[model samples]
Each structure stands twice: as C-alpha cells, then as structure tokens.
Target: MTRPHGRFQQAFAKALFSSTEALDPAMRELATQPAFAVYRNTVMKACIDALEANFPAVARLVGSEWFRAAAALYVSAEAPRDGRLLHYGSGFAEFLRGFEPAAELIYLPGVARLDTLWLEAHAAQDASAADAAWVARRTPEQLAALSLRPHPAARWAWFDDQPVFSIWERNRAQGEVTDELAWQGEGALLTRPYDTVTWQGLTQASCVFLDACAGGATLQQAAERALAVDVKADLAAIFAGLLSAGAFTAPSSSPASNERTP
Candidate 1:
C-alpha cells in the first residue's frame, strides 16, 4: 500500500517537472511560488550538468551549447532514478539514437555508449585481474580447458560501420581528428585494472573473442570463435593484449565443467 508521505513525495516530484497549471489546487499554488521555480530550474541544471560530466566525449564531439540543449531535452523526458548522479544518464545513448538533431552524426550514439561503459567500468567492484604470470602458470592443455571470467571492471563493444572508437578516443583525450584518420569500423575495450579506468581500441575479432569468453567459452573455444570472424586473427597477440589490459579476472580453482570444446 502507498504510504501518505510517499504519495505526497511523488506528487511533489511530479509538480516540480510539470507546469503549475497541471498541478492540483494545493500543488498549483506551491508550484507558482518563486522558490518552486528556482528549485525546479536548479534540479534540471544539476541533471544536465551530471550528463555533461558523464558523457564528456559526446559533449566534446558536439559543442557544449549543443550538448547542453540536447541534454536539457533528455532531462525533461527522463529524471534521475538513482540518488547518485554518477549513475545518471543511462539512457542518454538511446536518446541520441532517436534524437532528430543528432541524426546527421551517425557516430554520436556509439560515442555516448562508450562513455557510459567507461563510467560503468570505473564504478565496478574491485577484483584481482588475471595477470600474464597467472596464465603462464597453466599448461597449454589446462588453459584451453579453462573458461576465463571477465573482470567486473571490463566493458567492450564493436561498432559495425563507423570508426566510433577512434572518434571517441580522440575527443576523450582532447585531441582533434586528423585528416589521416581512416573511416572504418572499430571496437573499444575499457578496463579499470587499478585506480583509473583505461581504454584501448580493439579489432572486431578481439571483441568477438571477449564476447565468447563472457559467455563461458573456454580459451580454445573463444579463439575458434574469434578465428571464425577473422580467419587471419592473431590469437596469441590478441590474448596477450587483453591480458596486459587486465580484461579477465583471476582464474577459479578449477575449469568450468559445463563449458565444452567444439
């Protein structure tokens, strides 16, 4: 059952977003007050500011003025569900997909998604990353049989037709896109190995390998999946790179029996 205070709180929240004329008699009077307007504006500004902070790459790609305007529209449609603003704007990427103004910038949504992944990786739970030494300790047969768990702080995605990772990385590092940049598909991987979040561009094969690993595939099976995507994929180099980036968690006591070789 809805408690009296809970109902009042919900009504007050709705009134803050709605026009004064839309509120009940009591709320309408309160909403018309100067303080109410100030509070509403402040709340909206805070949400917009949070989004700008969260998706800095997107904001940098588009100028601040444009980003803020778009963010304001998003804020009006979706309020923060979590008290912590760090987790806000989970839907901003999706909003960009359908946003008419951003239609011309085909890569905007991908950049926004990467920014969100970075935040999520940064906020993920602490875990010991599987280091190269850990892998070296296992024999080839043992490693092939083992199913590696992805680190809690790891996030990755592959973009089909846009150099999304390149664009995002440049803007994220406050660098300009050079004329030499190739317009091709790219993948991105984000991992918080230690204190700071780190990101690197990935190949489609690598992304597919990670996807297979996340789905409980053994090392050999994941390699096969990656090879299926790119016949010439360098499995050894890709595996080493992922290890260096701390993408996988420390191995469990034993291999998962449910996983099978193909």
Candidate 2:
C-alpha cells in the first residue's frame, strides 16, 4: 500500500507534467488538491516563460501570442532535458518545421535557426584579435600562401531565397516593412568579440570561396577555386573583404608561408 506522501508525489507529478498525468491519479486530485494545483500551474508557467525569454527573436517572428501557444505545447511534450537554459530550444527550429499549427509560417524555421545561431555565437569563447601585424609579418609569397582558421564565433549560414534578415531588421526597425519574400538568398558572418552579427547577401562565388577557406584551403587555392567558377571575379576584392572583416586566423607554419613573411 502506498503512503499518503507517495500517492501525493505521484499525483503531483502527473498534475505537473502532461506525460505523467495519465500515469497516475489526475481528475480526482484536480478536484481535491489545492497545493498540487498551485504547484502544477507554477511549473508550467516557468517553462513557457523561460522559452519565451530565451528565444525572443523567435517569439517576435511568430508573434508573442502564437509563440506562447506553441511553447506551451512544446514544453508539455518535451520537458527540459538539461540544466542549461540557453540550450533548451536548440532543436526548436526542427520542431517548428513539423508543427502543424506553424505550417502557415513557412520561413519561421529559418528565422528560428538564425536566432539559435546568434545565441551560439554570443556564447563562444573569447578570442584574440586578427591583428594587422599578424598578416604584415608574412612575406609576399607567404601572404599568397596563407590559410586562415576561422574564429570560434564564426557562423556560416545558407538560405534559399529566405528573407530571414529582412524580417529581423524590420522587427528591429524604427518603421519598416520586413516582408519575408522581399529579400533574396542571404548569408551571415556572426562575430562575438565586437559583439556584432552582420548578415550580408552572398553571391554564389563568395559562398564557395569562403566555404573552401573554412575547409582549410590556402589563399592561392581558394582564390583559384573562386575564379574557376567565375572567370572575371575579383579575388583581390574577396581577400580584402575577408581580411577587413577579420574572417580568420593564420595557419600554424609552413616554408611556403615563409616566402611572404619577414
């Protein structure tokens, strides 16, 4: 026979979590237990509140009312599995993809992804600056042979004609219409040291070039890859932009790298 405390605990958990409710007494407790009722409501509220606060951009994109509604359903189905609150909604974009009620908001998932990206970049470890002297140290040939390691804060995104940035800017705008389809394909380079997140529309060539560099291509090789695709593309402009933006760090060491550095 179960003690009164044990029975109450079972009922309390059921009352608190939707999944556990069917596992134990429910209706009887709802009618009879005042403390359990209060506890259950408080826990549920906390979950919804945390989700809303952590993913404010997501809430704004979908609207507070709709996001709150979805949040409640999501929380009930997926009790937080970890202690880290910021990571709670990491999988939410995928959840939004299949969420029936959110089907009308086609780009909601991508927006959610960008929000997640922002949070991740914001949490990345502090890094040293990509000083000009670092690049200047290289000899001409070494500069040409240089390979850059991306910062921990780097975020590379690919979108398919999604107006992810437009919506974000409009919501942040003093007065502007951030229609989703108004913008074309976009990509972003997220950095944390300066605490800046800049989204820029990328040409196909630029994406391929940066991607190769990210994959450890040396400067000469990456530029060759970019030019192969678009013969007239300005490799110098790409290097200048990447360098100005502090897009990466120097390679460890190589003799080929020595020819360009002092």
74-163 per-residue lDDT for model 2 (tens digits): 887777766677777877888899999889877788777777877787777655435556676778798778777666676656676776
RMSD of each candidate relative to the true structure: 4.6, 6.2
Cα lDDT tens digits, model 1, 1-262, are 9999999998898886676777899889888889989999999899999999999999998999999999999997888889899999999999999999999999999999999999999999887788677678889999899888889999999999899998899899996556676889999999997899999999999999999999999999999999999999999999999999999987655342123232
Name model 2 segments beyond 4 Å from true. 1-17, 21-34, 172-181, 195-201, 225-233, 250-262
In order, what lDDT does every prediction score? 0.91, 0.69
TM-score of 2: 0.74
Give me the runs in candidate 1 sitting further than 4 Å from their true place.
Answer: 176-179, 254-262
lDDT at position 164, candidate 1? 95
